[model samples]
Target: MIRFDNVSVTYGDAAAPAISGVDLTVPEGELVLLVGPSGVGKSTLLGAVSGLVPHFTGGTLRGRVTVGGRDTRTHKPRELADLVGTVGQDPLAHFVTDTVEDELAYGMESLGLAPEVMRRRVEDTLDLLGLAELRDRPIATLSGGQQQRVAIGSVLTPHPRVLVLDEPTSALDPAAAEEVLAVLQRLVHDLGTTVLMAEHRLERVVQYADQVVLLPGPGVAPVVGEPAEVMAASPVYPPVVGLGRLAGWDPLPLSVRDARRRAPGIRERLAGLSPTRTGPEEGDRGADRASVPDGSSGTDRSSATDRPSGRRTFMPLRGASGGRERGSAQAELPEHLAVTTRLGVRRGRAEALRGVGITVGAGETVALMGRNGAGKSTLLSAFVGMVEPASGSVLVGGLTPHRTSPRELVRQVGLVPQEPRDLLYADTVAAECAAADADAGAEPGSCRALVGELLPGVRDATHPRDLSEGQRLALALAVVLTGRPPLLLLDEPTRGLDYAAKARLVVVLQGLARKGHGIVLATHDVELAAELAHRVVILADGEIVADGPTADVVVSSPAFAPQVAKILAPQPWLTVSEVREALR
Candidate 1:
């Protein structure tokens, strides 16, 4: 379906080519995974096929890229629409209409298909992607996951044989993401559509992938093969893979189930094997303990608490619960931080949760998971009465956020919005954080001391928006921490971070969790959900579908299941150390 012949692309710079003399071919109906560290040109490579590299991004290109035998250089994005449909990591980045139906029909209309044809295609696409119910819903109001599905449906409507998605599910919670992925799988299996997807959270998608393409960061050749080979070489593999590798298996296993089939001897070999690095002690604050070179944290968990809860569990996590947690949310509440809630929410077009309660127990971290349209942000905003649930109860310590004379929720509940940049106004990271603290009424000494602990070495002179994407994210995180809000509402915390950055971000959140604060964060990172979430919940079409321990919710939905390594080798493990112990 797509071919790159000795392709090398260069942009204005004093450096090497982004992609150098690469030759690759994707068959007519196949799925390909594109993965590498941030900025290794994974996006650039995908763009080349769609003619976005030289057309939209503007870079000199050498060699050839062809789709359906037509040269990419010969066609612009508009010209290539029939053969290719592309979805990026950010859902909002591609919206061109006000409602889901209009967005789905936009591409077909541009293609000049007859009105009847356009309508038919739009209806079919909507049904196929599970957007029929949301057809008339405002695009602006759709949840992140729903919006992404609409984007994909818009392209698939054109009946393109090949679909390319760049981190399409990066912004969805586990349940919602599962719905989108199921549609993708059905298209591929039932309709024979070809797929090329790029993503950073390998643990969630690796199991379903037909093939794995591993790129070892910048200036490295792409490694394409079975999922096991590629994932085994992944410096930052999933916990289960890290464990399997430590067990010294001949070829690393891909899914946890695969590991199981090959586990007998390896398990015996790993038993009681002292890991090279003990990594974080139980009491150590979460930090970037890069267990492996790729942030896979290859610590061998030769001695972790054995699973007392027999790995089987059925949790009822319903209603609004979605966050970008790629880790666990353990309750370690401190007496100082408390948030209380009683059935809080926005029902229909009005507020509900009248007796709606709110609470953040001492040292407990909870995530408010839900679909995009489900009232996650609204509920968080309610901490300060941003959208007062029509009727409900709420309190921050002794004061009700709404009834309180002033909006103390600003200080009591720190917020890191989905678009972190929106919270930024200062010229530098320091300035932005200082402003957040000031708004929170925090003492200067308290703000500085607390912010410094989480974001070390960042300065006030560095523009908060000017920093690298990762740095900007850290800056935003710092800004919220400075307020010392006992209750935190973080929305999509790890949207664009790379593996290393994600690992570090998780460590910071974990550290805070240990410090005793009640947090309710929403995210689309399932691995983050499994690792860091104390509990997991699923939301679909504005209602909670599942809830309970992270492992339970994720495992129940095959679409959100952890990487193959987890299935192959069953162990309550996150890093290499945990895996080592499971094997032992």
Candidate 2:
């Protein structure tokens, strides 16, 4: 469907190409999964297909890009609209209509599709997307996932032969992400539509991808192959995959179910290597992270040797006397905030929250999850006193947010929005955090100490707004965390961060949870939730559809379940360490 021959794009004022010398071809109906670290120019490849590269986004193009035998330069996006449909990370930016039905018909109408044809196409798209019931609903009323589905549905009405999506599920909850993936799978099987997509959360989606395209960092050639080879040998992979490689399996399994079915012998081998749990890796995740020194980090890193010629024990944590519980949070502290009751909220004409409720006991960590538009943010905003619900109330440390002034509440419940750039306006990272300290009545020295520790190497002179997306996110979070708010609300906290940075955030949030600060992490990365959250909550149509222990909620839901590995081990496993623990 699309082809790249010796393609290289060097953007404005840059010394080298963002992506250099890449040659690739896409057949008529192949779904290719593009995987890589951030800033690797994955978007550059998509831009080439859409005529954004060397056109809308200025740069020098060195080779030809062909879509359906038509040069992208000649057949711009408008010209190729009937052949390709593209969706991006921020779905809201691409919306062209007020409601779901209108948006779906917008693309068709632009093609001069006849009224009868347009109507049928729109209705068919609504049904295909499982969005018929929401056909007339305002676009703003949908969840992040629903909006994303609408975004794809809108473009697909033209029946484009190819679809390109960039991190489309970054902001959706587990269930919604699954729905989107399932919908894509059905489309590929039924309509024969080809797909090219980029995603970071591999543990959830890698099992089903047809092919994986790895764009190694900036200025490197992309590597493409089948799932196991690309991921098992992946320099950039989730920790669980690392555990799988250490297990000495002939072929590394992509999902936990695959890991468990082959684990009986793997378990015995793991026990021989190390009978007890070990601490985290010393350095950043590298080929070296797998290179454990003195079998120290390896007391349980892997089970590569087949019993060292003989040994066995599948679920090691079950029998270990000293290993810690996988999902265990630290003992409580009296200083942390305690939350109880609901935060009522309304967005325009929609009743986003109708007697919706939540509780965060001191030092507990709770993950807020639900399909898009299920009122996660609205509820978060209400909790922080940013939005006023029509009724009900929120108590932070036994005090109503409504009773506290906006400025006063700022020091009580700290909240971070989905987009980091929106809340940041400071010229320097130092200045941004200093202001937060001022608002919280915290000492200037203390604020600087907090920022430096959270994002080490960051100085007072660094411009907060000028940093990379991950840096900006970290900076914004530092400003919020500086408030010393007993209760913390983070909305998609790790959206653009890399693996090392994500690990740092987990450490920070977990540390806070250990210190007895009530924490609510509203996110779509189920793996993260499983690893970090003590409990999980699911919402749909603005109500708490399910709430309980993380394992219970994840195991019970068909769509929201955690990785297959967690479900397999007889002993509970949350993080990759636990998976290793269970194997040992």
Compare the candidates by TM-score and give the number of the best one. Answer: 2
**TM-scores for every candidate against the unseen true structure:** 0.75, 0.80
lDDT, candidate 1, 1-584, per-residue tens: 88888888887652666777667888777788887765567777888988888898777889999989989898998888888898866567787888888898888888888999998888888766678888887766565667778887888878887898887777766665667778788888888888888877675577778887776755567777877778867755665566567777767766566667776765465545533322112344334342101111011101011133321111111121122121322222235454444444654564433333344554455555655556565555566544454544666655566564333334345566665555566676556555544443444444444445444545556666434334456666665564445566677777666666666666666666554445677776656665566665554433445656555566565555555324433433334534545544
Residue-by-residue lDDT tens digits, candidate 2, 1-584: 78999999987766567788889887777788888765577887888988877777778888889988989877767888888898876677798778899999999888898999999988888876678989988876676667778897888888888898877667766666767788788778888888888777776577878888898876788898988898866666765576677666667788777777776765554443432322121212122211111100001111111123121111111111221222232221244364535645677777887767777766577888877777787677666655555777777655566566544444346666666655566687766665555544445654566555556655577666434456677876766665445577888887766565677677766655544557888887776777777788887777898888787777666566555435344444445666566554
On the 0 to 100 scale, the lDDT of residue 410 in model 1 is 41
Q: Relative to the unseen true structure, what is the C-alpha lDDT of residue 421 in candidate 2, on a scale of 0 to 100?
A: 59
Error of 2 at 173 (Å): 3.1
- Residue 529 in candidate 2 has what lDDT? 76
Whole-model lDDT, model 2: 0.67
Q: What ranges in model 1 sit over 4 Å off?
A: 6-21, 189-192, 263-338, 347-358, 370-374, 397-399, 402-409, 424-475, 482-484, 535-577, 581-584
What are the runs in model 2 whose C-alpha is more than 4 Å off?
238-240, 266-338, 342-350, 397-399, 426-475, 496-499, 556-558, 564-569, 581-584
**Model 1 residue 314 lDDT score:** 13
